[model samples]
Target: MDPASSIVTPASVPDPRATETVADLADQLRQLRLAAHRPAPTDNPLTLRQLAVLTGLPHSTLGNAESGRVLPRVEVVYRIAQACGVPDDQLPWWTAARNRVAGRRRRAPHPAPPPPPRERRAEPVPDQPILADDLLLELGGTAVDKAAELLAGRAPESVVAFLQRLHPALVAKLLATMDPVLATGHLSGLSPQHAVACLDATDPGTAARLLTLTPVTAAVAHLTAMNPEAAARALAVMPGTALAARLPHLDVDLVRRTARTMPVEQRTALLTGAPLPPAVTGELLFSLGFDGSLALLRAAGARVAARLLTALPADPAAGLLAELPARDAAAMLKQMPAEQAAARLLGMTDRQAAERLAPLSPRPLGDVLAHLPVPCAARVLAWFADARRRAVLQRMRPERAMPIRWHTETATYRLWLPTLATEAATSGATSAPTLAELATAGPPPPALTPGTGGPAATG
Candidate 1:
């Protein structure tokens, strides 16, 4: 008490922030451990066997730590982390508390220091990176055959980009997930825009890294050709952009099939078609992370961009089109069969779009088009190439196209303006219908309440 008191002063007393009694802490920890499927001494709250299965660590290891016989080893600590969904970094705090209660004082372990810089051994030559063939062995795929599938397919530009980026092993692993037809479809879709050197000819390690970012179709090819060591290395360090550039070249069909498998930023990057720098491409995709892809397409700010994106494959294409402004939406809407555009417009958050759309009837269309969502939507509409839109609008039947309006909320009806125009314009009399005639059809389409989705509407 005298020695302890000498070190303690009233103002500077060390408050043992370790406030919980060691025994209490240990008991609490044990309960948590049990609930985490890493029960101390193997008594799990859920079930002993279940706990053991969850941790993947031997029960004896955990048991030895709890009975105060031995401190748990790093192995058990990691197992606990997995079972409890705790991060590895939190181990020190948990273990510190555990030991304090047990009254076990031991020096903290330190990692072995790196060998003195000069003493490092030199790496040898003939260290050709391992091939894709070897890596595929681990996943039970045939590298050569897999490679053949890629080469045979009509891959897209994007698919080629993926092939250029991934390591042999990773490619093999990814290919293991595809069937011959799917692989062929993916390859067929690809355009292979990236230079073969940035991709196919790179060392295996880089290839592996790139492939991590690449789509399944592209990576499979060169990866199948890689040696094991090189493949592994490539899988470790390749950039995603390298993978992205390869994809745009792929066929639309394959991209649609494989897009869900890759991250959104990568998908967007591919869709951007901006000729991004490798660094920028990787950065763009990486920065977006996962959720950025879910964001609106208008977020990109360029109408030309949103317009260009319209040409992408369905899944990714639709996602891009989603962020467009109203007029742009309308422009796009007018291009499609009324049903399709209306369906797409249905996904928007523009609360007043319903009212604006009320004038799908040319008689009412101007006012509706006036309040349409903006410079944003207008920018998109500017890109409409309406001559093109009008051509498509001319193909439908009168009954399907006139007086495009939604009268009943009770029933969800999509009044496609284009359908009406198509039907009216193509109705074909010596004299074409006037704009006024088209706007106020004397009688609408049977379902559209006269004037809509009918031949007279376009007249």
Candidate 2:
């Protein structure tokens, strides 16, 4: 061949296969556009501007897609196909061809295979001198001491996490060496069982401080697990509200034991300040017995005593009142507002109300009784000895006392009439006292004089 003929020009060479070049994708797009129906009523295919409108793509972008200097993104290729009326099923094929050309153009050269991992001979561990037992102990203790020193200043959350992995005895030692507030914070994050174990190893005062900082339910669990004496000491130092909230949930015997461990004044302060449940209050008071309970109530003062009495169930409240010296019971009642005292008494049996109220001087007694309804007042008064009842009624205003006195006498008569009839029948006597005679028999209650300080009379 001649030299010129042998030098083939680039333009004279054939193009690469359609699947391998971006121009193939561009040509495909052009063919799709020519075959697509025109948007306007004219004998022409859709123009790039019309196609851009249909595709919501820029006109220049559409022209560039057809120029084929760079491959359009697969998404752009798919959108143009859709605008050019490519069938839904055929749309993916057009994108696949675009992606194939893109894959060839952007393909990275294959990396050389990684060299086989080199194997090396294992090195022997250096020989260590065997440590004596005592030396090992000293080293271990030093390590623990260092850890505790460092951990003491760390955040509670991290300290707690670290402690959770240690033995309980060691945890307790670390906690005990830290500042109390920091230790308490860490203790609070521990599980109840773990916290209890740690607390058991610490001094009661420190244990108490930790428990007070802990959540109530968890603290209670710890208290329950601790020795009663220690728990009581802890409780004694805790805030009144915290003590109050947790005390009632503990065992009665344990609580009683706790009370015994505290100083009398401290016990009174804690119990009085705590709003213990009625049943728990009753149980604790009963466990203390009359003398201890009386001493505590006296120290707590009459107002607190009245509140405690009023919160108790009727049987226990009445029992406690009856157990008190009459003077003290009367004093407690006087400390309460008349209406409140009356309401408290009304909740008790009439006999209980009368017994508890009997020692109050006539004025205060009449004040409290005045808040009772006439019939209720009468029922309560009928339980009083005749003379005391008369004195109380005499201290009231006539309008208030008369109706109550009448009801009192009537109820008393009705109560006695059956016994009188029984006696008469047994004796074979023909006559029993008539209702009128019986009603008249007791000396009429002395007429009442108005008294200041008596409660406003309820009709």
Candidate 3:
């Protein structure tokens, strides 16, 4: 009989029930591979490398499947059988053999019962291990107080080492009695929980200093675990940048309480770069009251002041802008994009927009006005008084300024011309209002006809 034919007998077919061990399964897989007919120069029917290409499994994995020491997963067995050209009808037989071996191994008893479960022990109290008989005797059992007294005179390293071993509450008391600077050094070495306890027992300023030295994430955790009022007090003493960095991670209510306790300068700092949500920032500004909020904006410098103002409600923002000194308000507006400045101005009454923007130099004012809709720009300009309006228009490049000037003329005509015409016709007056009289007339109408501007409207 041909060698391949001999390998393909009924005895060589993998029988799932007979494959009780991984070695039996591996032998069946090898016989399957050997019995497969494939083009090969050597006696082997298929090389492992060729099988790898056909199956898309690594050669090493293919070798391991037939190594007998380990049972290949059923999927691997199926893939290898398919690559070997096992008849599709027989693929399940190979897979079943692998599963039978796997199931048998799972059911096999352990060589020995699991070592009996070890007994669990109670956690010892914090200072028990470190408290010596002599030390206990020296303090008459007032360990925390006596420990503080003894550690006070020691070197910082010694204090840190001694405190690290005690209970957090005991460490907290010991730290309270030490000089703050020395205590902070020891606190830095303690775990976060212990550090928090010490900070809670200490004054805010000292707590703030220690926190500044701690990593930002760890410092935030310590603050979150501290009493809210105590945390707020600690935050009050931190530098603005450090405080800003920490506040976003703290709970919002805690931050609100912190804001209430912060000085104006620190609050300004907090608002400047802290990544707080807009609503929280609005609430913080509101808690400052109008005057305090104004002071914060003024002190926050132009750029930040502009940002904070934009976040306020329209009415509050307009009121704040109205309250700012003309130069300061103009400077804040200049810091904003022209479109943003125009929108802010548009939200205000004409007189309010005029007052806030009047102090801006002609060039910037024109730039801002350019962004306003023609009718809105013309109305705001009407409140600027004639000379200021003319100066702002002249400062704009001609092409840009022409549209506004024409719209301004058209708006003026629309507002006063009809009334003047009626008055003339009714009273038998001989002429219409002069250009100067029309230009100087009461504020331009709030809005003009949307499409009503051209040489004809200008006339």
Worst 10 residues of 2 by lDDT: 1-10
Evaluate all candidate structures by whole-model CA lDDT and list the values in order: 0.39, 0.64, 0.67
TM per prediction: 0.26, 0.48, 0.50
Candidate No. with top TM-score: 3
Candidate 3 lDDT over 1-459, as tens digits, reads: 122222244554555445667888878778777766644445656667776776788889889988988778645786777666655445546654554455456545567644446854564442222233444455446656566656543334444556666666666666666544445556766776767777787778767876764557778889999989999999989977687777777888888888888886666656777456666687678878999888888988999888887776655676788678878889899998887787667556555566678888899999988876665666567666679989999997665566667666664546743453454346423343222223334444333335543233433
TM value for model 2 = 0.48
Query: In terms of TM-score, how similar is model 3 to the real structure?
Result: 0.50
Whole-model lDDT, model 2: 0.64
Q: What TM-score does structure 1 among the candidates reach? A: 0.26
Per-residue lDDT tens digits for candidate 2, residues 305-334, read 987877666545555665566678788999
Stretches of candidate 2 exceeding 4 Å from the true structure = 1-139, 143-147, 153-158, 215-233, 236-257, 337-403, 409-459
lDDT (Cα, 0-100) at 331 in candidate 2: 82
Consecutive 10-residue window with the lowest summed lDDT within model 1: 1-10
Q: For model 3, state the Cα shift of residue 446 in Å.
A: 19
Model 3: how far residue 203 lies from native, Å? 4.2
Cα lDDT for residue 324, candidate 3:
83
Per model, how many backbone clashes are there? 90, 0, 0
